[model samples]
Target: MGGYCGYLATVGGLAAGADAAYIYEEPFDIRDLQSNVKHLTEKMKTSIQRGLVLRNENCSENYTTDFIYQLYSEEGKGVFDCRKNVLGHMQQGGAPSPFDRNFGTKIAAKAMQWISKKLKEFYREGHVFANSEDSACLLGMRRRALVFQPVIQLKDETDFVHRIPKEQWWLRLRPLMKILAKYKTSYDVSDSGQLEHIRVSSPW
Candidate 1:
């Protein structure tokens, strides 16, 4: 039931050891700060049972990307199947954009500075600050500047949302993503539809 938030969940899920993840983004971005790594784990292991398709056999469940795409299509009937759908608004996978790379450098530098400052303060106080919930903080970019805030101050202090907010802002589009599935292949009138078709229609 989320857009970019759903996508980033896949990203974080992949980093946390998922074989493959699908990120669906589309119009009307929304932000749901509640999703986190623990929620992801719970999603994978829950009361609902999922079919595990074996080689040379088809299952009733839709686990593949194609099936998910169908779920995204107009016929999907608002199936929040995976709470994952629609990636028209998702970032294309590739090398980092120059802006993102540069932003990363700045963010890393700021975080390092914060860490160093905290270490110095700890040394002065003769105490080690290792994973203290009260001392824990989230680093982010705001107004083009890196800022640090204590985790206690945020309703969500999860590692995912606290550090990266891209998906959060796009969460609202999750519903539209499912609906986009209807328009997926209905419009292919462009000369560049050959490549653009795949690019726009499929969220892969």
Candidate 2:
């Protein structure tokens, strides 16, 4: 948990809460950073206002668009009407990419394999083996196999760190997305839309 927290902070910044939100939302690895930047930049260029609003709303659970609105409004930033620009249901109507399908399959397979192994281990340990007559024991077995029971479930121990705030994370990485767009990095849809290169020429 300590290690995971540090990794989250290093990857997504402190704005990501201690929860597993970083796994789904924040860029935790170099590959993730590159992929995320490419996706975000493309979205921004196609629809800057909409993209920015989505990012603001979903960047972190703790730091919301409302929080930003209040903070900036106090400093004379005018009210932003998100309703007009919101895509709403349109965002959910996209086909799943090959990457999504492949990754989902892989995770499902791994989870099933883990569950099988855990059940075997539990049986070998000679824990009270209730027969088919015992539905409660069967349910307990399922729970033990499928549930993620951490060795230490303390409140202070989280799977995310607090190195950079969420807002700062967005500020720093958003430019990288713009740079990728400006350079026209290849985005092959079939190949999981990976960025082919991010070449930076030295000014020397």
Candidate 3:
């Protein structure tokens, strides 16, 4: 589930009375989405038996959340009420968050320093123009620390086909989210000798 906040919306679902959240990164599969909806509807039935009501607000690619709600509505007929909440480009056109403003300022200052140093090196070498790996670099945080990575050097770490980074830092937190949300999964070996995870019903 995606939009301005992307996968963060799934994390926020906990506050909206979600028992668990299923997140799919880039290259989302329709099959997986359908499976997740089936499982979620089953869980909702269990919740209804426990005298609990649920509402959801998922964010993602345009109309993706709407599709999800529609699936729930169809599956949960006479079981629970499901509806879509449109936010109109949710949280868009607002001033940048305080943390964003501060972090951006820091990165800009560091980039300026790098540019000044590069200029000084060019002047010392008596070069009319400079073209090097350092000449074109990206300035930003890596693992909570500011880092400068040359664009040319990121080829091995870039997924050109998907137009995204191969190593996404936040993906590591997904498993933690499942754990905190009480998603109990068990692995089973298939006939083809492949292991697959089977989700167990959660009491939440």
The residue ranges of model 3 lying beyond 4 angstroms of the native Cα positions read: 1-66, 85-89, 124-128, 184-204
Q: What Cα-based lDDT does every candidate model obtain? A: 0.42, 0.37, 0.57
What lDDT does candidate 1 reach at residue 31? 21
* Model 2 score (lDDT): 0.37
Candidate 3 structure quality by residue, lDDT tens digits, 1-204: 132223554545544445445443533455655655555556565644321212223323443655666766786677666655655566465788899899989988998898888888777556646687778888868778999998889989887764556666554444444454344454354554443555666545
Which digits, one per residue and each the tens of the lDDT, describe model 2 over residues 1-204? Answer: 212122322233333211112322333444543443344444444544332322223344554446534432443224222232333355454788997797667657766775576666557466734333221211211222434333233223433354222322222333343343333342222243334445454222
- Per-model clash counts, in order, read 14, 4, 3
Using lDDT as the measure, what is the rank order of every candidate, best first?
3, 1, 2
- TM-score, model 1 to reference: 0.36
* Winning candidate number (TM-score): 3
Ranking according to TM-score, highest score first:
3, 1, 2
